[model samples]
Target: MTFAKLRVRAMMVALLLSIFAVGGRGVSAQTNAYATAFTTSITYQNIGTGTANINLTVYSSSGTPSAIPASTLAQNGAGSYFVGSVSGLGTTFNGSAVISADQPIAATLVQIPAAASQVKNRPLSNGFSSGSDVVLIPTVLKSFANYTSKFVIQNTDSVANDFTVQFINPANGAVVHTANPANVLPNTSVYYDAGTIAALTGTFNGSVKVTAVKTGTTNPGSAVGTALELQTNGVGAYASQAFPASAAATKVFMATSLCNLVIPSGATTTFYAVQNAGTASASVTVTYVGTAGSTPVNVTSTATTIAAGAKASFNPCGLAPNGFSGSATINSTQPILAIGKVSGAGLYTAFEGATAGSAKTALPYVRWLAPAQGGQQTFIAIQNVGTTAATNVTVKYYSGSGTLLGTHTIPSIAAGAKASSNPTSASPSAAGMGVGGGSAVVEGTGAQLIVVTRVTSPVTGGTTGEDYNGIPFN
Candidate 1:
């Protein structure tokens, strides 16, 4: 990949880190229930062929910056760092960050709440490489089922800009409310709470679109953002990066979907929200492909229609058999964006669907711990989206210092099929991998693949967890 592409990918990773660094409060200090503190662990893998020297510049919400010590990683290796443990940033610190690397890398950030808070939710998001003038958020809520949504938008350009947020009703093509345009400083972020919007009264579930424009002109400006849905009465939370207009597609793929999959904590199910991004109404269909047995069982959604700027949702809970685990593909007549949420027994996670697959993908966080041990463990689901079956699919695990831990292989994966791996059962297990977290890279020879990873807290009978999309090496 060219230097520009690498930088774009790395920037995406940095965008996510900045989100939590600022506590999603922009220039102000996070407060009250929103003030829940978290320590962050960042995992990054060098996707380039050469060694990488990575540096981070953390910017406080006030725009003051602190330079973090540099770290190095070998080709295809991975490394990690703890943001809260770093010195110099006093307590109550909140801000944005920028990452610079000599070689291409993919990164993810995991936010763990302080023990005192007893918050089990472990929310995560992948880095964003670039920004856009317009962004789409597939799902947003306002006092709906005791849940609400919040978003933080960062201006990626060197100049200040004004952003307009429009909440669109999914049932009809209408703008329920439009928040007053907010002006944000360059390289800084601003937060919006749906609960605070009086126009968005009780029980509202819909989609959101944000547009950034030059401070004094109608010309488009650059920005990136992330949104989170929080359970008002509990600790449940899930996050997803806002989708740029360019990310909308006629088709989208989700690597993993659960339909009443019984786990220690509870039965799991996945629901998807598809937003119509085009000017015209959209005709959509969702196809679920089961991966549980020898033969694949396919289920399709009824003909659904969504008005422009609106969103439609469907779940496999009642459509698929109990204990069903599978993948989903969404087809639409109009360009659309999609996001999936997996929920059950206190576990909540949201991930953006893939508009396209890559030959290789990077997973920045992977963990493993025995069920009885009671800690976080990760389950990875990879889908072969290529025309032909994928063969010689391999995953390489690397330690925080870039040391090769071990490799796991999936001999062959038929096209449109899925495969999975669990670090707890890794072959030729590497020391410390099961107890300590690491990073990994998945490669599918001459085939395209997409990946989604689920991290469950407490190993088994976990009450909270999160999911994130694997970074593709463009």
Candidate 2:
């Protein structure tokens, strides 16, 4: 071997390393999950004809029972109850809750970041589901610049359990960072701050796979019950179901409304992230339902193919180009799971796909009022996803205390059509209605109507708005 040849090879290796900056700086892989403090708000709506007796249970990160609180709510009509209203939860308390109702009820637990004093922020929302050993987080962003996710995982089991999270890059189907945020004791909740974590500091955007293994076993099959939440940049998203499950459906229905032709500056849109969790690649078709007025309008997206191990994001309004505000249904050639983020007018909600003809779509609680200092307003949007037309459908407005204040009933809604109402203008204040407390419930007979809500603050000058989804009583 010649010394001159060896010198040439060493010089080439050094040149490549310098070009890629592969010498000293390295990306960190986040490992070990820890509990970080966050603000949580729990809201529940009574769907029964009568009042509901609700029981609340709280658990800490170590899987210990936190507290037991009980409250009985009776009002003029349908309304909401914050768990802290009857419990000892502080304004900044962080934990998990389980609400049980004597009568039929619907509820959600929301974790809010420190909201701007004069503006609104996106809050992570989740509707409680039963025991599961695994959770699939469809979307996450950390290396995307000013985009990071605060992820929460809680145990629903009564006994201690072990948990692990694998952050994967969707583009290449590679596990980017693996972290064990500590084991979960029974009934406890844990949090992970991706922005501050050293292991997850490297730039990457994709999905999360969370598994809760049994406390004493290393088997992946020994998963206990678990729940999850993820939030970033004033927007939140949640997994509707945890386990590796699939629906054998060809179509999925989503109720939507209002796509501003010129999207506002810093305006995040309503979008769906379709993840093909299956092994074989799949193809999907997306179609929108426009409002039926003096003129009929419709919009659709080109058929898309999602790789077997990857996912895609879609903004329906941007698919073709239309200002139509209404409903949408996605059809696929193979099985798929969809996680939707609906945002416009400063509000966002994590949406779970539903089957067609499945609603008495009602947003159990909404707020609208004009006060001297500030104001609160609400927009209720319902989309009829059924084949049959929805007729004589009504959005019944009520005071937060349960008194029916006013009503706005539309004459008819065609199949795939949507109807929206602003209670502040359309429905005047009625009996016992206060200034800031507002509530609403939807009713109709034939086809199911999908309902989603938008609530804004400072009612008059404030720019903050938050979106809440309606309860579809099965």
Which number leads on lDDT? 1
Residue 122 CA displacement from its true place in model 1, Å: 0.9
| Residues 168-264, model 2: lDDT tens digits | 7666556778887555665556665566666656765677777777677864422222222334332333323333433334677777633553334
Model 1 / residue 170 / CA error / Å: 1.6
Model 1, 12-57: lDDT tens digits are: 1112223344444333333222344555566677887788878876
Number of clashing residue pairs in every model? 8, 11
Against the hidden true structure, what lDDT does model 2 obtain?
0.54
Question: Could you tell me the lDDT of residue 3 within candidate 1?
Answer: 52
TM-score of every candidate relative to the true structure? 0.89, 0.75
Deviation of model 2 at 315, angstroms = 1.8
lDDT for model 1, on a 0 to 1 scale? 0.76
